[model samples]
Target: MGNKILVVDDEENIVKLVSYNLEQEGYEIITANEGKEALAKIEQENPDLMILDLMLPKVDGFDICRKVRKDGNTNNLPIIILSAKEEEIDKILGLELGADDYVTKPFSPRELIARVKAVLRRVDYTADEEKQEVLKTGAVELDLKKHQVRINDKEINLTPKEFELLSILIKHPGQVFSRDNLLGEIWDYNYHGDTRTVDVHVRRLRKKISEYSEQKHIITVRGVGYKFKED
Candidate 1:
């Protein structure tokens, strides 16, 4: 079997359909029909990825996403939200809470599988890369191996996505990156036309880092994209 995947949906048919398709691809599948069960399975199975549905009994997908990201044990776990809600706010909320990707209901199984593969590929690539011990710029310091970031010697917590975004910009100062470019680099997939994801993340990243440093590290290029401050 390949990587283990957890499928959490209240609909039995949806669960069966997804499990069948994933199993055919040689992945081990663990399933839960409700939010609470999903959380439990995550701890016991330690799946490489999770397909989470928003509407579920007891706990909800948003809360689960928050919890998973907050917990040190599963903070780095990859989550893909599978929901029927088409509201832009819902999508933004899920992403803000730390979901790696979002898929609406009535989705193509092939596309979903492709997203799964892309996400796993990014994860493997990050893990396999040879990185310097630490990256330093101004007051910001990033420990690549430890996955820790500190500003002026004071550590701040950042989600995996935020950390990756900062790492990319700080590595290449003065290079402007369009929203599309950032979406491709950080998300590791074409996010259709949702550039707002990049904006939301940048806003949050700025807010977090701003608390510690007076100088702005990430700069908006007005109509363009963004760039890191150079010396």
Candidate 2:
């Protein structure tokens, strides 16, 4: 199936432009004119990915991002934020709020499409791996080949990043890695960006994993960094 995307924006022109370009790329496009409506549509449509505008009536982008990140079924879904807010803090806050990516406004439609394609590509690569076989960790069986994560045979919904992060941790089992280390190893980006990127994703991972186990699956070392639970 062609990728499905939900574009949430208050501007009609922005909506029409993104919708047109994405549609031309064969992505099924869905849109919302305001934040509250966007949230409602997200609940009903459950698109593969979302493009959210930071400025909107009622709920606003940060609130919506938090709402989706908090939801059990939707927590793992990829969300990309679009905003004209130029402040570095705005961008940082968006990422910290669990946006998979961010695009500044007055932007290139070509770049938007490129980012969308890249995120979809990453999600697809992992999903494909999870379909063929199951991976196991002690009593936890995470079948990357089957896309099923079972702890004592109880299934769970893990986002692509969560699953990938967990797999790396479990496979390593005792590695003490810093955020920078993780960004280098897990995230495909080789160049510049804040290491907080790793920190934010780690927070999400911790939150999602808490749903599956009472014992912490991730651990933090004071004055150092984080590591998978090794005891």
Candidate 3:
């Protein structure tokens, strides 16, 4: 038995296909066909990751993702949205709602599995060589071991990806990180030219941190990427 994954979809064949492929990779699979059931299983099963469909009966994937991200217990849970909606806004919305990744319908099973592995890697990543437990830059403080971030001594909630993004920039102040660099570092995989993912997370990070402090810690470098402004 490996890491348990909860697959949520109304289509029977899609569920079967995803379950078969994940199980082949030595992962334990749990399933739910509707939004309500998915939420219930999420609470009970506490899956390591979730493959969620957007259009589900009852609650819908967006609501589920929102609830999971808002809840203290499941705020850090990794989510990958599986949907047929190919619009840019939908992708942005999913990412904004805290989905780690998005895979549209007719996706390659291999690619999805690769993304799952990559997301898990990012979640489990640790820098054993770095001795610093806390990173302090201006008013922002990041506790690596505690997996926490506090601005002006007031703690603010940040998703896992947001925390990792901040950690990278804060560790190397004034160092410009290209979008590609950030995608590779934070996502642990190539996003196939989708730099918008990085943008969405950065925007959210700024919004959350802004509530606690006025200092602009993350600075966008015109045509390049972003850096931490310690001033």
Best by TM-score: 3
Choose 1 or 2, whichever is better by lDDT: 1
Decreasing lDDT order of the candidates? 3, 1, 2
| lDDT tens digits by residue: candidate 1, 158-193 | 776788888889889999999999988987765664
Better of 2 and 3 by lDDT: 3
lDDT value, residue 53 of candidate 1: 97
Each prediction's RMSD to truth: 1.7, 3.6, 1.5
lDDT of 1: 0.87
Candidate 3: segments with Cα more than 4 A from true spot: 126-132
Among residues 3 or more apart in sequence or in different chains, the pairs in candidate 3 whose N, CA or C atoms overlap within 3 Å are none
Best candidate, lDDT-wise?
3
Task: Pick the winner on TM-score between candidates 1 and 3.
Answer: 3
Instruction: Give the 10-residue window scoring lowest on summed lDDT in candidate 1.
Output: 124-133
lDDT of each: 0.87, 0.78, 0.90
Ranking of all candidate structures by their TM-score, best first:
3, 1, 2
